[model samples]
Target chain A: MQERKRTEIATLGEFGLIKHLTEGIELKNESSKYGVGDDAAVLSYPDKQVLVTTDLLMEGVHFDLTYVPLKHLGYKAAIVNISDIYAMNGSPKQMIISVAVSKKFCIEDMEELYAGIQIACEEHNVDIVGGDTSSSLTGLAISITCIGEADKDKVVYRNGAKETDLICVSGDLGAAYMGLQLLEREKAVLRGEKEVQPDFSGKEYLLERQLKPEARKDIIEKLAQMNILPTSMMDISDGLSSELMHICTQSKVGCRVYEEHIPIDYQTAVMAEEFNMNLTTCALNGGEDYELLFTVPISEHEKIAEMEGVKMIGHITKQDLGCALITRDGQEFELKAQGWNALSEKNN
Target chain B: MQERKRTEIATLGEFGLIKHLTEGIELKNESSKYGVGDDAAVLSYPDKQVLVTTDLLMEGVHFDLTYVPLKHLGYKAAIVNISDIYAMNGSPKQMIISVAVSKKFCIEDMEELYAGIQIACEEHNVDIVGGDTSSSLTGLAISITCIGEADKDKVVYRNGAKETDLICVSGDLGAAYMGLQLLEREKAVLRGEKEVQPDFSGKEYLLERQLKPEARKDIIEKLAQMNILPTSMMDISDGLSSELMHICTQSKVGCRVYEEHIPIDYQTAVMAEEFNMNLTTCALNGGEDYELLFTVPISEHEKIAEMEGVKMIGHITKQDLGCALITRDGQEFELKAQGWNALSEKNN
Candidate 1:
């Protein structure tokens, strides 16, 4: 391997590093009045409602740096928050990122991370308004806050799902989780091995799903163009089952999702069969899909059914019915929030 | 001895813990249209400019939990960001907080931290808009984003200082730094001691200054009431010398601050003498003051001079003069940026 040049972060210090990283970052949004080089960034939203969402990603718990690149980590961190904004029927306008890294990281590592963040921002047309960088004692920690804008009447909340609303989900699930499993297995297989590359042929999609998941920005834009405003919506980061339960609990309405309707890619099904894992369970409980889960009025069911990349999986029910999943075998099973909980004993 | 009840955070899970901690949070600001329990918090800033600032505090780096209580840490974290908004001459209206913790922490610990954040929010009339909570691998990490509102023409930036501008700072400095020193010494003295209390009778002010520093909200209000708007402003979190240098550099100007005019509390002076540290150096370079450092036109000097707890320390000069500090004996020394660099070798 060729030796890569390494620059000590201390050579630039805190202020110098911030200046170097944020230099020439021009604001693209009209709402971004002023950015960086100040105590605070100034934004103007004269006629729109501002939406704010934040996420925190910690090392070891949220990610493992052994196989994950710093750039992808940065991209995922920004995408998660941006997804939340889109889930709210809003357009992300600006982002503020805060990162704390240990001494093990070099300036080039941070550059790669920033480059990834910049790519995500450019793709979404969101401006990098401001951020804070500091030293950590152990591993890297990232916290991102996304600011978005929407019309007052266009914003969707989880509590708006009414009875009989059609439940819809964009794209597919289980791929990201399967990708994680594949990476973990490969890491174990390659442990202590020398001069041998792990065979991941034909699993590129799974790896991409796990390493670089995209937010459902297109789905949101399509909904807007179709004049379909979701009664309730949220991004599926904590698995489909967990998010469905949140929507039900918040909306005071239960749901009935059909297992056959849950979309899963061909790769995900094959991987589940190979791993001997339940495909439906993986589709329901696998998290980090970044897909949009939403409910719309029944009157718009035909419109949503015809929308590409979207699946009509369920319908909202009265609260007394309770949330349930109708299995393919004509059995009804109550939905349990078996999603990955960050504070659960398993994570610890 | 009393035994404190400790409950594992895993018992409540991430969602449960967040709901429990933020159960009764009521939005007090009209700008906060919706808060918590959603994909994103909605804010309506119909006519005012929005200000955003963020900070990241890490364990064993930005703070020492060995001596600093979690509640104080939470309070200080919120206040630091709030101070940034005030530095821009804005009124903080909402805050988003994200915390990552390790298995060592319990649910009760999080409650204490939230309680501190609640208290600060209540004091400042800022609403707890939204946040993220997750588990960390090692120590606790906190990131807070404060959003504020300001009139379009009233917002201030660091680059607005012009030649002949009068530099002013609110209240005294170095007390927080002295408090940190006192806490460190006492921690060292009380290490491994059983049931022995550290003697901090007369130094209570310093401890409070360090552990529970308040943002200069009153100073901002006073300036507004006096009809004086700062040409340039920023909080003195990174020491007066460092922050002054930032303003001078950004504004393309130089400054001449008098060392004798720098404010210092009596307790700080006494502590510096006891520690055999330079008092002037502490006043100039000791950070975490949370005080407002601002500059106004020379014509507003008379109004600022009459303002209580506010000191006129210097005047802006032409860019070629360079930033300098005049001693009590009229000796001129170029100002140096000696503020704590989180990425420096000393920190590592």
Candidate 2:
């Protein structure tokens, strides 16, 4: 918490505000022919297949600003869309952002958000081509459309998995879900109190996982360097069980995931225990990990096992076999998709 | 309005609702490689330069649901994005839509919205590539991103206007603004009463202009057929005066527009008189026209004059003359940007 001077956004008009925020931005991608200050952004994807993905984050629905810093919110929002590009085995090139905010926000607040977005774009080598900024009647709303490029034959789809393909995932899961739980607890503790800071000494990893998660760009690069083309690929955003089901349904196949082999961080396990929840269930259905999940031919199993930060947790099965989880006790159970459903949540 | 069945959105869930809305939407453009049911939409533009643009429409700030039907809202949202592509001298090829809605909306309501989107896409020959749908805490929020393609040398930008270039606009101005005024007046009349329909006889054109606007695709096609290229172009979303200012400021040039030449429909003039508002002011500052305002070489003035649906209002001037409007009574006034400012409105 730092005391700073706030400048009203009304001081600068809409065009003036857009110009002020995007003034110093320079296009860094060759595909980006024209950046801001135009009716539409011009791009040139001469020989590559263009990829487009969009995400909308709404206040109180997708996020709670009470515990989420504005910078981290911006960072996470960009990461969410970028992750979708990588999920299709593409290199992100340009982004168009549109935001609507109430008068509660000032120019400085917007600067912080754009700073986070700039950091993410610079790191990923994506250009901020164009965006629209306007006033909203309620809290903040952000909608981002990310464009990427992939070779004609390199793009992967979820319907490519076949029987006997090995299922693998990069990095561990459930940490981000654990982080959210901890944040909610801390927010509740400080609800009616003033000057009493909540303790979060050893749970820093959880908070970082929730607030500032990064897209799995390195994993995409590593797979390319290893020359391993996945049969099917997607990023794990809505929990492993839900995404796996999508692959199974689309590919017309089934899978058997090993409960014992599911990746879980130590911090996530500790937090799940403290909350008296099942760690395995958390790993399977707790989402927002932004980890790459894919399947390759079983012949490449040895190479996949050798790759650092990746783990083989299952294998594709025939359509009649059904998707299941093989427990450590040798019992098999159907995997239910209990992932977070924003629409369904409204009914409750 | 006819009575229709409404299904609860929660029953279908997010993914199910998306699948239901986007089912049977085949890709219509050759550039659209893969669409819907994937992490990202895939497109290919081998020789054409790609154009991208986005717009965010927030409830209450952008539209009033009480007076606007869901179908018209969706249609306008799509057109607003598509118009930007046409403004760039490109043909729209693909679109990605993201919407956030409160629980008050039902599955049938979304279908009506998507039906309008489908009609717009089909008419433009653009493909509905992909979209994200989530629940909002309040009213509806829509964000649409349109992708288009044009020849390498044909893309137009606002900064390309040069000295002595003739300024022209497609269709009529101020009708849409007048339509909005009529809708608001009717809404106020019916505020506390039921079954008392506010009469809008002899004003159907204005109502249509505000509810459903079409981009000037015909003008672009006609220009191409005539082998004419505008030096600069942009769609009129934020009033003619404000958009003209952008062209002048970006091109580092000035212009003199004749008030007598400004195009106005007969209906708009009558409505202006009824509202007791200045007719020229309404024509100059009224926004959401969605018409193409552009500058072509003076050498082609003869061909332009022969062109139907286009009115030549003025010509670009040297940077020293400044942007001004010459009245019919032989008076000159520096044009001011009194366009609708959503951000400024928040302060009031």
Candidate 3:
């Protein structure tokens, strides 16, 4: 055994660790046409069209152990995995969870986690089939794998969007990210005041959005109901601009998001102004919204615009046009994606 | 944050840690009638048959870093996951892997792991669809979720074995366990001798079995080719006798295994004798062979017997009669399953 000085992981950044960890993955399975390099991995199953997506959430990195409930963590883990599945335009059917824990957590904590997981399962109507459990050397870490089914025709790829397609996003933005900010602020107060009640008034919606953000299964169902098939789709886990840039690079298309069209929850808007942060920047770059972002032919814009859950944000453009955000005054600035790049993202 | 004295997990044993971590799990998915409470979880998918399987291997726990080549570890991890699919009598088509690594492991080590994974994927014709990567606080922990397909009529359950059915196992018994024993002994010798090269003559097969185990996907295929579906089946990861006992318990049937009929390779037999360990104990309780153990009706027994890669060991009996092992001299002793209960079995 070789003994060496241990270096803190923070110094390497998340991307560096991912790069370091996945450095030697050689795809041996024919089904693995793509692995570890995209939003979701592709698999070719015999006689069936299938998609598999996975996400891992670690305590402290993904959530604050103090303010976030364990049950919510479980629910969020399942939702995020499903988010990837939804991004593929597939209906999720099953999930398997693997958890690693240390002594600090108790059976009660696991119960809460399961409670949230169960709630998500009931809401999504997916089965909780199996999972693995082990003790971690540190805090908690969870890996959830979601199985989804889609017809070969219905499955959408990140690269499928074409120039001139109408860009749309479901639900509102900035709420979840702002909620996280509020929760963190509350945690700071709770740390100082031994017996003070948290000021939760006026921030309930945003806080709930952050703590219990739901995947767009309803939007997925709604899209099906409307007989609308997006040319391309993705769930908003990273900020709006980041996901857009992904679409831009992958689809070989650019986009122009109108600033006025970006939806920000009222509380999120106020919070952003209170914090001296730009509302548009928070909407454009804040993450964990769990909303669906999709694109359709320009002909479908009026049809999609009337929908209850979706909002039109931009239009895809030619490659040379580049991705940009247009202000209410009509000034356009080049869009830079600030999505949580696992490579350099700082762990909270 | 609450600060506490650090406690070494080794003091708790594997079972204690699993119990501590899983105590709070709540199964909310209607399809998840069971989770973390059975050998394999049952999940009902909409418009599809139940998809199932598992996998998790920790470096220090399942493999030693020094002698275990990185390629073998990667390949072995894939096999173990694929083996779970085989145990369900399902055709594994895709898998997602999540890996946690410490900086101590280099990029070259990761490449070695992926190389092995690729080899297994090619051999199995499965896909390395997707996976996640992160830095570990300590040792490497690898987990894989394998997805497979099965016809409703062909799916096997551990609870389906019946009384009077023939008990069967594929390939040799105890070889992997014996191989592990041989490697441990060699490691011990090297640790003590310092300058001496470990002896390798007459130890090749056993060592290979330990370092590189195969998933019996071939056996599943061959069984299907012979049109012989097992009444029940599971992989031999926790030892042959224990798996048999599980089949007995789950199926509510007893079994009588013949010591003379248990397949033993020449290398395993010799090593048992050399180590002065009971060959019967090794074959009965040794685990990690990744072979299939199943049963067929007495009438179907002949059909299975004629197939290549199968050995009939015993017959399933009535539950009241109980499970037992018959000696070469006709002495019948009760068989108590000594499976590796990761949830409760102390490593010691």
Candidate 4:
């Protein structure tokens, strides 16, 4: 490994620090007319509807720095907001990031963070525009706002699902949650609270899933190419069941997803078993998957099922039936959202 | 005050809390196609250039709850971002707010904050399209992203100042800084560390300036009415001197401003004297004024001079001359940007 250079953030001041961090950023989106070095960024989306979304990630609450790398944290932060735009069936164009950090972070730390942000923007073909940098008294706080564009007719909303539509999800679930569990256990062992070394020999995929989740842009593109506009769509951030319930409530319908149809990675299942946890429960309610969950017309079911990386998990039903799940053993049960309740969790 | 009601935020959870706070919000902007209850808000500005800006406010850094009311803090937060749009010669259309609070804040506290945000949106004819709510482990964190629009030809940038342009500023300076000083003094006294009672008898304007600063939307309207477009523009958030240097550096020009002509309120001057601080320094370097600092073509000097709440304090000069402040006694001193250096200050 190369020796890392460190510079204290205080020496650069706010303006100097921002300039240093954003100096190399190049705008890739045509909509972006002006980027950093301005009080505000100028953009134009003359022929498309603009999609806007924001996400806030705070230290000690949303993430644990003890096991999470700063670069991966930054990458995940940007991906989270970009995922929202993709969930709307839009192409992300630009983003502004606001960060408040305490004295504990040095200039090199911010550079590493910005490097991850830059990589995400480059890979997603989005522009890093304007943002604010300040100091916090406690932990680091990151707030990202992403701007995207979509054709007026292509923009999808969560309230548009209809009865009989097919519920589909891109990518597997619960791997990220299992990855987090592994990291936590490893941390405990490192602190001498446990003696076992984490057996992560074949669990690289799980760690990647948790630390560097990507937005399902490919899924969006594939759906567009297939001429399939989802009746309703949202990104699975707060677990599959929670997101499914959101779609059901907004669309005024119910859904029945098959437990057998829930996709889970091999590593995730193995980790869940090793941890003595219910694999089905984790797949249903473990959040941070960053997968696309959508409902499409039943007519397109066969086409969607044939597509790569997509699973037709269920079908929308009448509102009276309520949201439910059909177990692999032919038993039906009502589904409950056990996603991260940030406020209540904090109180506890 | 009447008896206040209290509600625990945990009872509603994150999703319910967001829904409750935004329940009464009505979309007034034509560009806003969707609001809340979605992964992303949809907007369109087919014929206009869009302007985007973001600001992050952290507890104990940008503000102190000890003296700053939650309502006023929210109001000021919204105004600060809106001011950036107006600074770009655009009308704000929509905003997305992301707030993370600890368990210490209840639902009622959030409601008060949202009430202030609603009032600002209502008065400005802007829509609160979307936001994210979550829990923080420490203090409250707020990030507001504002989107606005303007004609392509009418949008202003800071890098357009011409040599010999007339530099103008709306309203007064240093008042916000004075207000902050007063608040700190009162806080110290309240802690019993200082015996003197705060002598804020007739300095209500200063207090208001610090607590509830308004964006200069009226000035933008007035400039439009008079058919005068600034050659360069930006809001005076980081005091006049700092913002002026930015304009000068970006425009590749220099400036000369008369220290005597810089606008300072009587209360601000009196308070500076009371604190034994230099009044001129406060006016030149104290930030958070939320006033517009702009430069118009020299041809419009007479028109701008006659306008209400505007003072022509200086003129742009060739780059060779450098930025300077000419004192009443005819002494010329190079201007320095003593804006809020958050990192260095925190380190100290």
TM-score of chain B of each: 0.99, 0.98, 0.84, 0.97
**Model 4 lDDT per residue over B1-348, tens place:** 587787778888989999999897888889999988898989999999999999888998888998889999899999998999999999999999999998788999998898888888888888999988999888899999999999999999999999999999999999999999899888877895554556778999999999999999999999999999999999998888999999999999999999989999999999999999999999999999999999999999889978999999999999999999999999999999997666666433
Q: Score the docking of each candidate (DockQ).
A: 0.90, 0.78, 0.06, 0.77
Model 4 Cα shift for residue B327 (angstroms): 0.2
True contacts kept of each: 0.89, 0.84, 0.05, 0.85
Instruction: Report the candidate with higher lDDT, 2 versus 4.
Output: 2
TM-score of chain A for each candidate? 0.98, 0.98, 0.85, 0.97
Worst 10 residues of 3 chain B by lDDT: B33-42
Writing each residue's lDDT as its tens digit, candidate 1 over A1-348 gives 688899988898888888888999999889999998899999999999999988888989989888899899888888988999999999999998888988898899999888888889999999999977889999898888899999999999999999999999999999999999999998888889876777888888888888898988899999999999999999999899999999999999999999999999999999999999999999999999999999999999889979999999999999999999999899999999999788888888
> In candidate 3, what are the lDDT values of residues A11-42, reduced to their tens digit?
33222333343444444433333343211232
lDDT of 2 at B128: 96
Instruction: Please state how well chain A of candidate 1 matches the true chain A, as a TM-score.
Output: 0.98
Number of clashes in every candidate structure? 0, 0, 8, 0
Which residues of candidate 4, in runs, are more than 4 Å off?
A: A1-3, A192-199, A346-348, B1-4, B192-199, B346-348
How far in Å is the alpha carbon of B43 misplaced in model 1?
0.5
Give the per-residue lDDT of model 2 (tens digit) for B205-242.
99999999999999999999999999999999989999
Docking quality of model 1: it rates as high
Best by DockQ: 1
**In model 3, what are the clashing residue pairs, if there are any?**
A15-A342, A15-A343, A24-B111, A28-B118, A71-A112, A71-A113, A110-B24, A111-B24
Residue A138 in model 4: shift from native, Å?
0.9
Over 4 Å off, model 2: A346-348, B1-3, B346-348
